[model samples]
Target: MALVAVVIPTYNESENIGGILNALSSLAGSAGLNIHVLVVDDNSVDGTVEIVEDFGRRTGFVSILRRPGKLGLGSAYVDGFRWCLRNLGDFAVAVEMDADGSHDPAQLPRLVEPILKGEVDVVIGSRYVKGGAWRGGRLSRRIISRGANLLVRLTVGLRVRDATSGYRAISKKVLEQAFSGERSYETGYIFQVETLYQYYLLGARILEVPISFYERAGGKSKLGPGELVSFAAWCFRQLAGRISGRVI
Candidate 1:
């Protein structure tokens, strides 16, 4: 059976994991696809593993990876990608989504469609697209979002809409090509843009599906003010490296 693994990296998402798993399970059953849900928990002290394990037992399609600690989002995804590739082999499609339901599980099928049909290498659940929106947060967030997107575009020279969007569908081949070895990628939100750019450099076709970007129902966001600053700094460094043709 063909498999698509949605790798959800959780820090302390006890309240949301159950619902997220259920949504994925329902989506899988409806589509008749062998959907594997991999939850890469960053050693949440709030019994996140137990919750995931219980769901895994009930669903039989869920898997849990207990990481050391609160590693950054990018590293969590990298580790999840490796785990999926190693276990699922060519049957895996690497998908990244927030555990807090910010990215609707209903939209998953749309993201996976192009890859399932062998038409694209990666599919991004884009918020900056025509049909997407930000549900909450302040006015400054919009400015920050635009600024980050602009920085990424100027730096990477790619025309992707949602630079920092976590919701993405990636074919195994594309994952292997983009993350073959440490490709100068940092472990943060900017990692999404970096990965997208890496795919672009490797000549992979990326499709962006419009998504309704919602706020997390339970937990607080990890991408706080400080992380955004660091993300901007990383973008400038990456920009310089890309322009100078340095090893990035």
Candidate 2:
């Protein structure tokens, strides 16, 4: 059986964490994939860690690494991926997902199937594809998402339809190559443009599977207001540099 690990970052997500853990636990035995989770939580004040610990006790399919304080999402994934790669028995793939239940765990089998079949090195659960859509969120957020992705493709030249999608699966080879050591990627994306661009540079074969992005199950949005602004600024700078024959 192939082993798959899902890495999620959490902070004060007490109201929402259990739903995803439950879904993942139930899906563990199906599709011939040994699914496990590594939740890297930045010390949530709202009893989030207790809930995760309790769930792990009952199912053993879940494990958590609690940080001392609220570190960024980038660090959470780095630590979570490293922990799973070293501990999970013959880990074959690593998955990234949101803790707020916007991304579905039921679709995980399909997300990692191509990796298991040696078809693609990365699979992004995209909303820009033919069957995918985002159900709710501020109108500003929706527009920012679309614009950021358009800029990611226009500047970075990646062929992916959704460069900002948080739900995705990566083959063991790609993970080992791009994330073997400390990498200083920013947060806000949950795994955004920089991470995706690194994957592309590694020559990873990427694909997008359409997935409907629902509103969060609970808690406020973690994305800060400045994230999009910073991303847009960077994209334009990269575009300008590329145009000037001095790619940054």
Candidate 3:
């Protein structure tokens, strides 16, 4: 059985958490998977935690980690990864997915298959690959997403087509190495890029699979101007480090 732990970071996602969890629950009996849904919430006032609790009660496979206050996205994921590494014994794969419906739970198996077969240590659900397609969202948003990915590939030296994509699968071995030390990983939306780069630095075998990226089912995106600024600053910082012989 594939002992997979999915870590979903949520903040006021009451409108969509159920669907996300439900979709994941459906993956329970597939490929003899013993899947654990770890929903890490940042004290949402919108009853997001309540929904998670409800699901956890109904389906014994679900669990949650409640945070004190509104932490950044990067921190939420970092905390979740640490929790899984520390708690989930025999943890085989750790998945990074969005609470929004944009990331299809159906792709979970595809994302982790490479890891299971030892073809790769990390698997990324990509939108720029041959069979990948990104739908909805504003034209500007699409363009900006593409541009940001281009910048990360050039500056961070990560070869992923979708560096900003949240849908990913990482093996327990990779997770142990990623958090084995005190890493000052970014704690914002830029967390996606930083983690991807770290995996690359570790020389992990990485594979990209096609995914249909859709708009969210409900709720609004939490991205803001501050996140945009932080992302640019992070890219520049990494570029500067490379130029200064920081060796990634």
Candidate 4:
């Protein structure tokens, strides 16, 4: 039996974290998998860490990792992944999900099944794939998501349905390889795209599970027009570097 760590990176998500944790707990039996959750909080001023600590005290499968400050999503995951590697060294799977209820914890088993069965190293919970869609997001966000995915596919040569989707499951081997070196894609959401591309480049098998995205009813989205713009620009720069042999 492979130990699995479900990581949720958060910042100012106090309102949503408890409910998400409860939902995740409820899925433990139905998922038919042993799972531990690691909530990496970025020192949210909203007392998010306190809530997480309280929950951790109540649940054996859940715990909290407090960071010093507001690190980007990429770095939060990186930090949490490293901790998972060290503390939960026996874990065979490491998963990433949103703390804002956009990603359904019920879908985690399907995303993790292929990796557990040794069919793939990376499994993406995709909202753009068949049987997948989003609800309650502004029209502009929908367009940005579609366009960003297309751009990522064309730029990185990764034929993934939702490159920007943060919901994912990765085999330990793949995570080890990806984080072994000094990561360069530490920018915006493009980090997700770059990580997928790096996995593709390294010949890691990838799988996609359909997912429906829902807008958060509370708290503000960290992603915005600025994030979208920066991501596009970063992708272009990365593409240029790759073409010129400046980056590999």
TM-score of 4: 0.94
lDDT of each: 0.85, 0.84, 0.89, 0.85
Clashes of 2: 0
The 10-residue segment with the lowest total lDDT in model 4: 180-189
Ranking by TM-score: 3, 4, 1, 2
Output the better candidate (3/4) by TM-score: 3
Candidate whose TM-score is highest: 3
Q: List the candidates' TM-scores in order.
A: 0.93, 0.93, 0.97, 0.94
Give the TM-score (vs. native) of candidate 2: 0.93
Q: For residues 28-117, what per-residue lDDT tens digits would candidate 3 score against the true structure?
A: 765557899899999999999999998899888888999999889999988998888888888799999999888998888899888988
| lDDT for predicted candidate 3 compared with the true structure | 0.89
**lDDT (tens digit, per residue) of candidate 2 on 1-248:** 88898998999899989998988887886556798889999999998899999999998888999999977777788888878878884889999998998998898888999999999999999999999989887788788788888888898777788988889999999988877767666655524777787888789999999998987888977778666577777777768977889843
Error of 4 at 54 (Å): 0.5
lDDT string, candidate 1, 1-248, tens digits: 57898999999988788888888889888987789888999989877799999988886889998989888988888888888877877565778999987888988988988998999999999888898888886777678778888888887677888878889999989888776576656788778887887788788899988998877788767878878888888778877887789846
- By TM-score, the better pick of 1 and 2 is 1
Top-lDDT structure, candidate number:
3
- Kindly give the number of clashing pairs for every candidate: 0, 0, 0, 0
Q: Model 1, poorest ten-residue lDDT window? A: 177-186
